[model samples]
Target: MNESYKIISSSILYWFSQKKWFVYSILIALFLLSLSTPVGLTLPAYHSLIILVLVFILVTFEPIPFPAIALLTLVLQVVLGVAPPNEVASSFMNDAVLFVMGSLMFAIAIVHQGLDIRLARMIIYFFGKSKRLFLMGLMTISAILSSFLGEHTVIAIMLPIGLSVIKNIDTQKTDGKNAVLLTLFSVAYGTIIGSIGTPSGGARNVIMINYLQEFSNVNIDYWKWMKHAYPILIIQLLVAYFVLQFTFPSSLKNIQIKGFKKKVQASDTKKNINHLFSCLIIVFIIFSWFTFNDKYGLGIIALAGALSFMIFGMISWEEINKNTNWGVILLFAATISLGFQINETGASSWLVLKFNDLLEALPSNSFNISWSIMAIISGLTANFFTSSATVSLIGPMAIELQPTDITFALSSAIASGFSFLTVISSPTAMILYSTGLVSTKLFFRVGILMFSISIIILYLMSQFYWINI
Candidate 1:
């Protein structure tokens, strides 16, 4: 019996080593659990959210490409009668999804035009010549881009430059490489922080708005989201700055180092007509993001941009078709379908009941304990789950619990930003991770420290946002 158990354990480990199996197994497990839970009306509806969350975790972490995992969950949902096939297909066409796609393509165009690099140089020029100031430029600029354009795009454009800067400085042993890592993370963190500042910043923020409107009376507009979120985001940026500086080698931290002047190598780089048009179409799409975005819907806008970019000039339609990650898109659509199913089937409500029941098990008279606990829960949960989903699931419920003071509500909301446990929680974090520039373990190390510090920063901000500090 012991031998059999050992063999089984070994097999499971072996399967997990293959990223696909690891992801699929996780989804299957979550699906079964959600289905069995007494949380919702139909197993398909309530169970779908649980399944979707699992899919989001897998895809965001990028152990597997998003497109593939998306299909599995989405297809499975339809086949299992969790969602109708047409509904599953339509989930792929959401405005939120298109908005993300348009943002990504626009970011690509900026890089292709060398605009991002030029912008980086400008940042360094303005900051002055000191290692500390250099670090500041790196973090601030990256943050700005990540917040507005996107973290992944910013990272993709900046990673090569960051590496080049250190390489020129003989950064190998002098903590130049560490500086690169810090810059990379700073960009990712900034993008994430910045994303909350705008409605188009990340999928979750939009989803939160939609979910709130759909399920409750709360209606958060794009501008209002910025107003409530920006202040908190600014505070996050400051925390990121000090934490990044102190955590890494002091020699490289927050330095305004010498900026790059090297031109792209003509040989190592090739610019094609297809690449050009691909980029142009991306630009057109971005233009539409603010203009025609709502008219046609986000998914249509993204597809239009992607299709037009493919047909335009950067690369051949075949080449663009070949290079793009369809699997990631598929995965995104699938997760949406699954998430909706979970909510519809009533599983979410069931879980809420259980949670409330669990809360009943514990004495909860003091607002302090409730707020602290909510903060901890929000931070920790979002580390593994998507931030928006975490907010949607916990936010309304937290409010429903009826904290004695506004402090608890603010704490719970801000604590949702503590998504540093894994790259999957935040899109910007995922984008940076996918660059293949930084390793998973390095991210793990940084994430742990960030999570720890986030607690203190959120606590401090609570004082400001709620007048507690």
Candidate 2:
């Protein structure tokens, strides 16, 4: 009896230790629920806010698997009477979720084709001898590819090339080490900056677009999105080149391009005919996104592109299944559902009202002030959590803040791409960190400057260029 009692106690302690954040979140939820609903908010809205707080904690700490947290998010809505089962079901799946799924699958298909080698060859041929020119060339290519292919995919492709160049450098010296870090940061920053360029660049963009359409009845197609964002992307790229150079000044003026070329030549550099077909399919999908996105929606078109790859036998379902992050897809859907409930229950409006009250002492509650606040909050939130999840929660609040103006939603979305401050903020950053060369301290140091510059640039664009567009 004593031994059995000890074993039971030990098992309970183990579970508690492993799932401490889960316990803390539940306890916090209970504490919040014990309080009476605020005067201006309905009971349902208050409860939804509690759930939001619970979810924020869970997502940030990740005490549970994402799929489980997703399930909890859906279950809490129904249990708390925030929404009915049917409403929850409907909100759980939407174009934004579909777009995320399709894009992940499509990215997997594209990455499986081993195009990074070819991309490396192009970079070498164009800007290989001069270090500064090579850095700019690499950053430009990474940004452009990430603008369409998504930053995570672009990082997976570009990191290897960056490392290849770095491996040839003399890392034992401070100059060589700085060069290595600079190359890696170029890839990472480029991918991050370009993620705001179009809807396809990141799930956050698509989520924000969905919010704009659902809340404000405003539709921004791929072309319009690029028109608003690509200029910012271009400007950020130029600024980032200077920032990275200033942060990591290396004495290495030139690199041995011949060595990299020989390495590429030794590899199986033969082009596959199927690659052309894959490229055509991708181009067709992009063209369709630019032309017919309004007709079919971005999610449907992205899925169609993934299907084309499967239909042509260019990528197998098994490969995609193995690679795609279904948990994240489900989480996106769940958080999106939670976002809908927050808006429907009027929690977002209440929060916005409070948000305004806090800002009421200002000279004027103008759109510019609101835009800057929203951008800074979204940008900072994204640095701590995943950008898509950040948008899933914050996008609704942004739309509620300015339902009539699309800039609020757009600024929130674009600013969320400033995931430069932390190693775990975005997958691109994580991948770069995984190379084990760049330190977290270095990341934070460089990120502070870039993050500030990005916010300033975004504000200027919104104030100047975006207004014209």
lDDT of 2 at 45: 95
lDDT of 2 at 279: 81
For each candidate, what TM-score against the reference?
0.73, 0.96
How many clashes in each structure?
36, 0
Against the unseen true structure, what C-alpha lDDT does each candidate score? 0.59, 0.89
Candidate 1 similarity to native, TM-score: 0.73
Candidate 1, residues 1-469, lDDT tens digits: the string is: 6999999998988767867655676767656675454533566754565565566456445666566666667667776677688877765566655554555554454455454445555666776466566656766676655544555566776666556555543335547566666666665676556655555555555555544544454655545555656677777788888877666664564233443544432212344444444455555655665566445654466557555544545434554445444554454445544555555666656655666666677876454555567788878877777665565455544544442343444455556666677767765567667867666677778778777776776676665554632
In model 1, how many backbone clashes occur? 36
Global Cα RMSD, each model: 6.2, 1.7
**Global CA lDDT computed for model 1:** 0.59
lDDT (tens digit, per residue) of candidate 2 on 2-69: 99999999999999998999999999999999998899999989999999899999999888999999
Model 2 is weakest, by summed lDDT over 10 consecutive residues, at 265-274
